[model samples]
Target: MKRFTCQSCGQLLHFEDARCDQCKAPLGYMPEHAILSALAPQGGGLWRPVRGCGNTALRTFCSNHAYDVCNWLVPPTEEHSDFCFACQFNRVIPNLNIPGNMERWRKLEIAKHRLFYTILRLKLPIKNRRQDPQEGLVFDFLDDSPDGAAPIMTGHSNGVITIATKEADDAYRERMRVEMGEYYRTLLGHFRHEIGHYYWNVLIRDGGRLEKFRAIFGDDRMDYQAALQRHYARLPQNNWREYYVSLYAMSHPWEDFAETWAHYFHIVSTLETALSYDMTIGPIVDGQATLTHKSDPYLLMPFDDIIAAWLPLTYAVNSLNRSMGLADFYPFVITDGVRTKLRFIHDTVREVQQAAS
Candidate 1:
């Protein structure tokens, strides 16, 4: 995610900030311009960007803002719609009247909004069910059955991504992480991984890249159910690290793609944050090389350049985490095989971006 600042007072801002601490100015994120702008009230719930903040036209907060779950702006052009570009994708939200569901929904929104940030930043194609009824991306945040029936499983089907609301609880998520033996897991990671499935349908299956995809990620046509059953039934290969980004990625070709795709997002987004902060890693030894953020990872950096910057950054941050008595900031390794899959995803994203331009 790119760093943001309050345009009115120049106070450093986070992507989710609703107000500027220095100037006490109300803030709203303008997704079209990808800026979090300080706002000036214009009566009747409308607001305009403070002078010199950008877009002079009046705007209003998304309907979800009423729930304090979204901080995105709704432009006059989209006044007919009640939700922002990101919120419009919601097919079902959690039951707010139920105790604790409100907080869980808020956490879900934060992660979902961040997911949309990367999606928009990369200029990926996305639509709501209204635009493409057959396969438009949508979300369903659901609760497990209260009567002791089967639990909700978070996954994607066609264009819908369902997230088990319980995952929003940190304790629950952490427990599951231990039981599943995952190196890393979070709500944002879940969004990134599942959206990969949605994009596979759009950018690979429909975009005519299946042949190339198969050669790199293997044949996705294999029996997915059987592959998953086998994966759970047997022990992971001792050498799985050589070929997969995570143990779960060894389950199926589709999973490998999704896992790698999620890691690709992790790499580029974190690199962009480092670049925004002008972060650099100087050589510890006299003649060793230095790492600097020289290019925009989302727009200009090649796959090789991204990997070069990411590996060193990971090393630096992971060490910082260890020094502070925390787990590695990035727990997975990027092997040559994993890099090949990541490169495929990077190239495919660039292709879609160029075509759109």
Candidate 2:
């Protein structure tokens, strides 16, 4: 996500905020430019844009600001946007009164918003299933009742995506990561990766992209049921580090696509962030700084140049994390085989944009 500065005090601000840290000014998302902006103060924590802005001029703040969780706004005139874009996608939010459901739902929504940041940045088409009722996006955030009435599983299907609330808990997520022998995992990773699966299904559901896809990820027509069954029955491949992001990602063609798609976003966004900070890159080249916030401004950089910058950036990040007593943030390697797969993903996303345009 692009870094934001408080319009009220010049201090940096996070995207989700109701007030500024420096000046205590009211904060609102400027949908006009898609960055969060601080508004000049009015009386009693009430706020208004500096003037001549569209979203403020229309009036759009979260209905739930009184209770917390959402800081998004929608104009009164935009009946559709009355709900924040993310809230509009919800088909099922776990019963808030249920033990830990509200906390779980909040975590999921936060990750979903981060995921949306990338989607919007990429300019990918985002149609919610709830909004369209036919072909738009929607989410099913659920937790099986302790009683056995509904199916307990949650996953993306067709245009709708389902995420179990358990996935939101770090302990639960870590437990699954250990059980599944995954080297890296996170709630945001799950959302981004699963959305990749949804988008891939949308982008290549027809036969045209199938043949090339086969050469890269094997084949979509392969039996996912059997493949998943086999993967669970056996040990994760030892050499997977050379070829896949994690063991779970190696489970099937679709999972592989989603995992790779998630990583593509990870790499692109991190690189852009590095460029924006203007820090020196890594050691191999001898002079470039890794803390930089300025790389290729528009990501129009050739594939090789992007990769060139990332290698050192990852190393620097890993070292910094180690210094802080945390595991490396990115725990996978992009070998030749992985690079080839990534190129396909990069090409696919570019094609997706081109076709949409």
Candidate 3:
């Protein structure tokens, strides 16, 4: 995520900002230009970018802007569509008429938009239902049934990713984190993890990389439901960390791929944020050298360079958290096997990107 600033007044801006705080200039994110621009009203609900902001053409906020959920802009050419690039993928949004549902949907949108940020930055292929009805990316923000039956389980099926609205509640989410014994659980993590499954179908299964995937991730042909059942029924394996990113990843090759894939996104995206801020790490210990990020992790950086920067950055951040009596910022460890899997993911992404280009 690149740091953004108000083009008009130079006020620092966050990705979700709808208006610049210092100058009070309206802000909108231009996905094609990848900049948050200050807007000048043009007439009849249209806006133009302020001077120096990329794209001089008139634009309009996504229809979702009416709900204050999206800040992305829509070009005039896309007038036929009401949603922005990110919001267009929604197959179902939370029932806004229901109490607290709007807030939940807002939280979900923030995380989902961030997920799309990384996806677009990586130049990964994406198609909405309109493009490919069978396996195009889409989302369903659902609530558990009112009848007290089974709750809405957050997972991916085909191309549809269903997220439970309850996860947006901090209390409920934290409780589930403790109950599941997960070190990290957040709305963003859910999006990243589930999208990994969607990509596995697109890039590995349909793209003819299954053999290579099986080599690194193990045979995914093993029955998924049986693997999940056995995973929950058995005790945690002492050597699980040696081969998997998480205990749940040890359940099946498919899961291992998704977990590792999500971790890849986490690493690259966070590293990009660090780089945008020009962050560097230096320890005073003997024989230790200073670290600085110079390449774009999403495109130009070597996989080895990414890991080299990632480990030290995690160590520094984790120590900072410990100083404040907070849990480690990053709780997982990457072993040799996990590193190999991560490299495989990196290579696959670059391969797909190059082929697409």
Candidate 4:
């Protein structure tokens, strides 16, 4: 994601900032324009962008803004809907009666919004449940049962993405990561990985690209439960890194696709963040340039360019983290096989966009 600034005072603003810290100005994200803007009231509860001179469309903050969860704008035309593009997809939210549920929900929304930022940046198509109930995208932020019922597992089924609200708790999430022996795990990773499943259903299964998908990801028709049970019961295949991005990815072909897909988003999103900061990699010992500054990764940079920028950025970030005595920012390597899968995801996304257009 790119860094944003307050239009009123030019204060650097975070993606989730609802107000400018320096200028104390109200802020909202203009998804239509893909910008964060200072808001100037237009009377009668309407607002206009302070920066976009030509943008006079009357708008209001998303209803979720009441809970201080969403920073997106909702035009008057969409006011009747009472939700923003992101919140409209939520099928369920945590029961607020429980203490601290709101905070957990807030954390979940932050990650979810970042996920949407990348999807929108890619100009990928999305269908809400209202638009296509059968296959439309939806989200469920659920908590464990009150009576000690089974815990909610973060996964996707059909078009619905369910996240265990506990994952928002830093301690719980870190515990899970250590328990599972994962190199990395986070709320954003969960969103990216699950959404990968959603896209597989849409762009590949429904878009007439299943055969090609199978060719690249292998047969997803393998019994999912059996594969999962086997994965947990047995040790990960030897030299798993030679073929998979993570151990969990080896559970099934579908998982392999999702893992690779998530990393594709990770690579592109971080590269965009780097571009926002005008970052460049290095001049090697031989004085040969490597990963020079470039255009937006979403629209301008090609597959090879993204990898070139991403690899160096990962190395630099890892080194920086080591300097601080922290774990590597990115622990996995993108082997030749992983790159092949990532390319497939990138091409598939572009192909879907072309078809939609």
Candidate 5:
């Protein structure tokens, strides 16, 4: 997530901002060019980039913009679609007529859009449900039963990711995290983990990398239900951290991959944010200092460099949180075995980039 500035008044902007606060200039994001620009009126409810990046096409915000859930643009060139590339994958949005559903859906979109930002930055392959009904990425934001019958479960199947609307509520989410014994949990983490399952289907199972993946993560052919049963039946304390990223990750090979993949996103994306702010965690105690790297985590940094920077950043941030009487910002430890798995994810993402080229 790079820092954005308003072209109209040079005010700092965030990716989700739809209008610049300083100059009141409308803002729109162009995913193809990976830019968030201030918008200028072009008549007939269309807008053009005020920054002038050689693109003259008039555009409109995604249809979702009307709902205040999306800030991405739809250029005139993509006349076939009314939604932005990210929103096109949504199969079912929450029932807006229901009270509080709108706010929940907004939270979901924020996380989902952030997930797409990283996916696009990584150059990962993603197709809409229309393009590949059997295995393309799609999202379903569902609420609990209206009659209070059953709750919506958050998980991924094939390529459709379902997120329970209640997860958007911070209190409910924290309760679930504690009940599940999870050290860390967030909306972005959910998206990263679920999308990891989607990518595993596309890049490993369909891309002929299953054999290599198995060598690292283990055989995914084991009965998943039984493995999950065993995991919940007893919390393994013997050497679990030595291998898996989390206890749930130890349940199945597929989950191990997803947890590791999620951590990879957590590390790299957070590192990019740190680098963007020129942050360095140099505690000038005796004779040691940390330095910020100029390299971009998405394109330039290798797995080792990412880990090097991420470790210090996590340590500093965790300490800061502790100082404020809050829980650790990053609670999990990255072991050597986990590092190996994360490197595999890093390499696999680079492979996707190469394959696309």
Candidate 6:
């Protein structure tokens, strides 16, 4: 979400831009540093990267050059690799040889990169299966076979994430949203929410925070299959709003954690954006705002401080959203009971950071 510049012409560039209109420079993303750099064309359509990146020594091409779905640079060091960091996470992408699959894959990567940007910004640990097969993350970008050979699924388990290829299609996603009765659905939201599932394995189960986590999210040891089946079997009761963020959270303790984890990123990222703009008035300077640097996350702003700020901030945002024609930016209100659950999530994150340190 930070602004990018074209190294070739020094013109401001968009993250999604394949070519800079001002200088006609080819652009590529430096995935390691989350940068978008522009390139000057050499003869024979070989674009020379003008950015002072280590990857340049490796001589790489952006995914845009291949499928137009990737903006991330693939270093020559990874010459044999077919995907960038965002695309690399995918285990079963649609058939790229298909006319539309490349475009579909492209959309999914954009959202995946956005998800990664937040994870990186927060200084969260990320290791893919290719890097660490034992516990590293992976993804499956699949679909109900075009030939009707198999059904597709999108969910997270253990350390892997799966996304249906149809989720990449705007029309298909909208149809699913209506059919599933969801108020909001986006590729970004799915990545964010599913990664929330991954982080539970990464952060909570390993951090010895399970007891406290169980106290709030219910017991995560419960059977996931039965819980999920029961949830879909009956409509989630709306009256339980005071206890959970979304109806899906009512499905199981693991779900509640995942939903809350996603919300934590939502709150932290937006607050940092607001702070970057210096958009606050009458600064009651929360201590976390002081410690959690806008550019570098040293530590999560104190868990208590964030909740205190959120209580009022979400209220103001909801009211403002109503004043405008749009629906509420944050549809779910965290009640007092839910606040206790969120506190556990916040504390567990700190524990993870401490353990990593």
Which has the greatest lDDT? 3
Which candidate do you rate higher for TM-score, 2 or 4? 4
Candidate 3 versus the native: TM-score?
0.97
* Residues 125-170 of candidate 5: C-alpha lDDT, one tens digit per residue: 8888878979888999888887988779999999999998889999
Weakest lDDT window of 10 consecutive positions for candidate 6: 289-298
Instruction: State the lDDT at 122 in candidate 6.
Output: 63
Per-residue lDDT tens digits for candidate 1, residues 1-357, read 888988777889989888888999999998998888999898998999877666778999999998889999987799878899899999999988889999999999999999999999999999889999999999999998889599999999999999999999999999999999999999999999999999989989999999999998899999999999999999988889888999999999889889999999999899999988977564456787676658889989988888878888889999999999999999999889999899999999999899999
Which ten contiguous residues of candidate 4 have the minimum total lDDT?
A: 282-291
The lDDT for every candidate, in the order shown, is: 0.91, 0.73, 0.91, 0.87, 0.89, 0.73
The C-alpha TM-scores of every prediction are 0.97, 0.88, 0.97, 0.96, 0.96, 0.79
Q: Quick one: RMSD of model 3?
A: 1.4
Q: Candidate 3 vs candidate 5: which has greater TM-score?
A: 3
Q: How accurate is candidate 2 locally (lDDT)?
A: 0.73
Q: Report the number of backbone clashes for model 6.
A: 1
Compared with the true structure, what per-residue lDDT tens digits does model 2 show for residues 116-174?
76776676767777546665678888777777588556577777788888888899889
Residue 12 of model 4 has an lDDT of 94
How well is each residue in 1-357 modelled by candidate 3, as lDDT tens digits? 899988887877899999999989999988888888999998988899889975689898999999999999986678667888999999899999889999998999999999999999999999999899998999999998889699899999999999999999999999999999898999999999999999999999999999999988889988889999999899997888988999889889988999999999999999998888878564445887676657899999999889988988899899999999999999999999999999999999999889988
Model 6 TM-score, all chains together? 0.79
Identify the superior model by TM-score, candidate 1 or candidate 6: 1
